[model samples]
Target chain A: MSVNILLFKITLLFYSVATVLYLVDVVRRKEKAGKTGKAARWILVGGFALHCATLLARYLEAGYTPVANLHESLSFFAWTLVGIFLLFDIRYRMTVLGAFSCPLAVILMLIGSTAPTAMKELNPALDSWWFPVHVTLAFLGNAVFTVAFVAGVMYLLQERMLKSKKFSALYYRLPSLDVLDSINYKCLSFGFPLMTMGIISGAVWANSAWGGYWRWDPKETWALITWFLYAALLHGRLTVGWRGRRAAIFAIIGFLCLLFTFLGVNLLLSDLHSFKAMEGP
Target chain B: MMNIIVVGLSHKTAPVEIRERVAFAPTDMGRPLHEMRALPAVAEGIIVSTCNRVELYAGTHAPEACVGQLKAFLAAYHGIPAEQLEEHLYDYQGEEAIRHVFRVSSSLDSMVIGEPQILGQIKTAYGYAAEHKTVGSVLNRFLHKAFSVAKRVRTETDIASNAVSVSFAAVELARKIFGSLDGKKVMLIGAGEMCELAARHFLNNGAASVMVTNRTLERAVKLAEEFQGQAVPFEEFPQRLHQVDIVLTSTGAPNFILGQEKMEEVIRQRKNKPMFLIDIAVPRDIDPKVNKIDNIYLYDVDDLQGVVQANLKERQKEAKKAEVIIDQEIGQFSRWLENRDVVPTIVALRKKFEEIRQGELRKTFSNLKDLGPKERQAIEALTAAIVNKMLHPPTSVLKQNQETASGSDYVDAVRTLFDLEIAQEEDDSELS
Candidate 1:
């Protein structure tokens, strides 16, 4: 196997270990939990560094950005998600977040491993400066939304536990609703603008290459739908003071739409953005 | 083994009259601490005296004698008869004593569970003992471990995270709403003792300013002067309502003083800033409907009591978790104490055998003028093996039984049967 493939395998191993450690932290609930969480964070950092190295190596071999195919895109997506999660973990000091986020990242990386790893040349139509900017912004926005989705799920669980007045491990482990709501708001404020910029850049790139900006392609249509859903969420929150459980539910819905746009549109439907060369034998 | 022993009378075992009589004055603690250390069996001593409890923690080789002397000392020092003091006093030895100190430092033994003052009180008492040069290595290590256990319990549980009093509950609710009380203004409408107490709670939590108003201007001025706040006219208080973040109304007015419509305008004037209104009067000063307004949260006396009750129940639950932590730490400390007990005995036994073997070897060597170096070495090895063979069974028994309650009995029997002179100074040196 190539060095990049070996590095990718190592990254997968680190993420798997981190996921187990985070789960152990959830179950142990004391000094052991704190120690395991710190260990998991360090391992995740190591994995992230190796993931970056693998991407760079692949970039060197491909003579372009490595995210032109399904495998590379999925790997990039997981890397950005873990990066966003680390930032949240540092700021909030909520180690329990790893219990949810690490597993999600591991699943994404596992799926990436299944896809073909062979580097393919970019389509001539896709050769533009705006491509990398659009892809990075889109993935970064998805990563932020991923954090919001996790926080939303935790909020719902905490709210249920609180309303029922049954104090369990979940109740003690999850952060308060006020904290989760603020995090949800922050993620939305950050992710919405990046998503808008990603869509705008994609539109501009399409106009330059395909001579049309508003094609009703399945991917573009779904991206627009996801953007509108988040737009409504932000509008309701800022104007009408929509928050708490209602806001949490909307965040979950918005993430589902985002997931369908990113994954379902690329795989289940034919589109101009599809990388046909990714399905290598 | 130097066992830890605690003798004390707390609020649970003694009334305030008896507790106050037994409590040592802070200035006079040095005399009793020194006297305690001078006792026959007490290797280390610390006296903790607070309004709620008076406790003595000591390290002693003979726990029974130490406890007896401490009881006599308490009665003699306080000028009370020993018979009168015995009914109110309680004592714990060994692992129980360790657990008691751990629970006390964690605030689990407080009159109001999770109250924070007992830890500071215990620390001050320990400080007095440490300064007087009365406490030694055992007590120093024990107290430090208790402190760490207390810290661990605090971080690992939510024992102290709730309010047990009405005023404290109001402050806790305000914190939940506003995050912090810093720079927030409080307005008191009319004068009631409970309302003033809650206002003081907010002030203590860092509210910036206070405004007092009553039906009579002079009364308002009097109350304002007492609180170091400005006096506002009762009629004009509603106009200035937007300036304050918290409103505490306790007027005896039979009707509601603040209504929903007025509060809506007040909230709007404050630009939707959050407001906490606490109505503490029996007839209820603020209208309950006002609570429905945006950014306005109102709680009456019953609601505050409800919060206090809920918080108290939560503290009780967290206290159970703290107990589990204390149990684990007690197991660890007891094991350490057991090892400390056994090591010196083992050393003394070995030293006694080696001394006899050396004396006999020297006598035989003096008589054998033809002794070769090889022959001398062979004799030394043979004597050492015989000593080892003879000592192994008792040594193993002592090591194996160190953790049991009968371990000390076995140690004493061995010492008496062998006529071992385990010099106290020599044992201390061996331990060091």
Candidate 2:
């Protein structure tokens, strides 16, 4: 009912339209599909800019960073994903990633709106600046990993077609396996450090707030699992020379773990981070 | 008259075992072509040798005689019974054969339709034959046309889409794991071919550094130099595995090299950061139990195969769409070939009728000497119309026959019966 909520809803609508255009482009393989892809990207960017305005307006209206509750966290996470995608576009000029990343952003935004929006008491730990820092870094890491996941999926699909010797229009439309793999690796390289810093910051925050730095909480465990998966990917590249599809699979699994950590831990189980699930399904 | 016929087993009709038996490795292609050309009726020849196929493109003056000679040549070359291979041999003559070569060079006839490798293979074979002086005017024209068709196919269709091979698949999986690999350290624990492929994928993906450890330091060093990675002692592999985020092992080891206990220690040293392990070796090098470690993610051969199989299925689906494009190209090429045979006969027939009309015009002018020049011109035009009307039916028939399989033969028959050859000879003599 609020202006911010309305704008957020509008962003989702635009994103949905973008997803359709991309899918049509991929299937029909028409030259006009490229034009559609460009239009979708521009619309997504417009929606993202509007979404940023909504977040800022909400911050002014609510008297706090909008990353406090489950809905707010999801919104912030989606915002970071678009931010990362824009950054990728600047460097790689990969328009197709908008097709995958935009839909993901839309899904997250939709899920975000459904979460309970009632103002709740902020715990002492939440009052600290470190809370925002940790959450923001972790989300950014996840956002970067999400892009990597998309690239990895494309890479696998492309590689398979190549191996099977099946050359088609879709195959040509998709980025080369080499390009996707490199992009995935680049995303992970950037993501892994952010995630590591987030985890470390979270650990320090936990130690300051609760007198324990490391706990075997479900969220923490899953985050560790995801981090380990990425770590293995990094190590495999250095020591074992694991580079292409093998590396891509690991990156995908890592992002999946990250998704589990972000959403699954909050929805499926109870832990120290249970309070964070105020908006989760 | 000559015909170029290509009939043999390829990767499509024959398995590797069968294809290899008949495959003339690049080195053997020259001698085989020379030997096949020495047979009766053979005029010129070229051999296409690739991992998936072995086809002999032969232009012979006597096609029927050369078919037997080609069969015998294959039988003797591979020691396979001629009858056993006869079922796979498909023969095409003249224009049909030319179309076949163009389709093949363009990858329209490939097992994995639209693959680009066949074009290069065709080019290489053609180049070799040219060097040997084995392919002359007719074959030269055909081969050049084939190259042009290949270029056209690539330009016209979206056949070169997001294709990836097994080597790159490993790199893609890595990217999925780490998100970005710009400054990531990778450990390659073997110097096997699969490892080299994976390493190349990594280098392509922006992995900043790579280290290879192998028992045979020579092979390790060799592969390392090629991939811009370092080679370390095999025994120290576990020590480096902890520092790096990814491990790809494809060694020729007999036993497991990386155990769970070893990985657990490595994880501790990594401060519980994630680690990805890929063992592409047979008699697997990395222990499967390592997958149970808190921060270790291990993938064996079967796991990679699962990804490979899934990717292959997706490609197969795309291939179906590509086939439609190839079929359309084939139809267009056939139509063009059909149209080419009709133009010459149509030109000759028009000239013959014009000669008759001109001869009648001269006779009429001689008999009516008092008529004005304008009247004479008018009379000549009227006579020309009559000749054109009389010739219309046969010309239409000739045009219709041009599209049929017997079109060329019909044109030849018409030319001989009308004494068009003699007329052409006399015209040439007059011009000279």
Candidate 3:
């Protein structure tokens, strides 16, 4: 196997181990199990380092950004998700969140690994500097939205437990509603702006490369729809005080729309931005 | 086997009159703690006195004798008759004693389940005992374990997460809405007793300032002065509503005072910042329809009471989980205590065997004046082998039984059969 493949495997192994440890700590719910959470966080950091190495090695071998294929883009997406989650873990000190998020990262990596790992040449249309800027901002926004999605799910679960007056193990392991809500708000505030910039940058790149700023491509249309959904969530939260259950439900919906825009438009629908290099000629 | 004992009266077992009488003053704790440690059987002692309970936790070699002495000490300390105190006092020993301390420290046994004060009270009690030099190694380890167990229960269970009183529930709701009250403003309308109490709860929780408004200008000024707040005329309060984040109203008005239309205008003027309105009046000063308005939340007396009741029920459920945690910790501590007995028994048994071996060797050596040095060493080795061969079975049995319920019984049987006299002072050093 190549060095990049070896690094990818090592990253996957560490992420899997961290996920198991986090799950065990969440299940045991004992004070002694706290060490497991700390260990899991350190292991995740190691995995993130290896994941960065894998990306760097791939970039060197491909002679262009490696995100021209589905596998590379998914791997990059998972890396960004883990990066954002680590920032939250440090700020909030909620280790149980790892139990919720690390598995999602692992799943994304697993899906990414299943795709073809062969390097592909970038399309001539994608060789502009705007390519990297637009893709990075888009993935970073998705990563923030992913954290918000997890927090939203946790908020709904915690709210159900509190409202039903059932103090289950999950209830104790999850943070309070206030904490979860604040985290959701923080993610939205950060993600929404980045998303706006990504769309604007995409428009500029399209204008430069395609001779027009507007496109009726499937991907472009879905991206607009996803942007509008998040814009409405942010606007309602600021002006109409949409929060708690309403905010949580909207965040989950917005994430689904984002997922469809990112994956569904690329795989199922014909689009101008499909990165045809992934189609194996 | 019951080395730890807890003797006390709490709100559950005694009335406030009796609890107050038995409670030890902090300034006077030194004499009582000293007297408790001075008791013959008590190796270590701590006296925990609070408004809700007065408990004496002691570590001792003789559980029964120590309990008797503590009972008498309590009678003598307060000059209360032994019979009267006996009716109110309760005692727990052995595993029961350890579990009681764990539960008490975790606030499972508080008058209001999950109240946070009892843990601090116990910590203060332990502090006094340490300062008086009454707590030895055994109690030092046990109390620290209790503290960690309490912390685990707090983090691993939602026992103390919710507010169980009306005033506290209001504060909790405010926190839920605003996340933090550091710079939040509070306004009090008409100054009913319950409203003032809830306002004080908000202030204690970190509200920046309070504003008071009543029908009578002098009364509003007086109430505001007491709270170190600003006084506004009752009629002008609505015009200034945008300045406050929380509004508590409890007036004698027969109808809704703060209606939906007025609140909608205020919400618009405030730029839709979230507002919490607690209508504590019987007729409800704030209109119920206002609850549908965006950025406005209103809870009346019944609503707060409903929250309190639900929170109380949640605490009761969490208490069961806390008890399970205590049981697990007690099992661990009890194993340690049992292992403590095994060491001394094994030491004493080994000492007895060695003594016999040495005595026989001395006799052989005296009779063999003409014997060679090699010959003397051979006889010494043979005698040592005999002792070891005889001790191997029983020593293995004792070691294997250390964690079982019958471990202490086996330890006592061995001590009695061998006529072992293990010095108590020697074991004290072993613990350290």
TM-scores of all predicted structures: 0.75, 0.53, 0.74
Model 3 Cα lDDT, one tens digit per residue, A1-281: 88888899899999999999999888753323488889999999999999999999988988776778788888999999999999998898778889999999999899988998887667676578988898999999999999999999998887665444344666547775668888989999999999989989989988887788878788878888888888898998888777777788888999999898888988888677675833333
Residue range B1-432, candidate 3, lDDT tens digits: 428999999999999989888889998788999999999878789999999999999987678888899999998899899999999888999999999999999999998999999999999999999999998756887898898889889887879877788999888777656768888899999978888998899999999999999999999999999999999998899999989999999999999899999999998778666788998999888889888775577888888888788778878988999999889888877866764587767877888899988988889789878999999989888888898899999999988876544555677678768877344334334333
Best by DockQ: 3
Tens-digit lDDT track of model 2 for B1-432: 445687666767778877778888776567887887677667678888788777888866567877788878987987999888777666677666776777778676777566778988889999889988788644675677567666756655545432345665566566545556777788888767777777767777788888888888997798778778788888777677777877888877798877878787887777665677778889898888777664356777777766656555655555555455546545554443333345666777788888877887788788988999899778877887888898788788877865443454566577777766663454234223
Please tell me which model should have the higher TM-score, number 2 or number 3: 3
Candidate 2, CAPRI quality class derived from DockQ: incorrect
Candidate 1 C-alpha error for residue B238, in Å: 5.0
lDDT of 2 by residue, A76-108 (tens): 899899989989988876666776787788789
Mind giving the per-residue lDDT tens digits that candidate 1 earns over B225-296? Answer: 988999999889989999999999898999998888999888777756668888999899888888766457
lDDT of 3 at B8: 93
Clash pairs (backbone) in predicted model 3? none
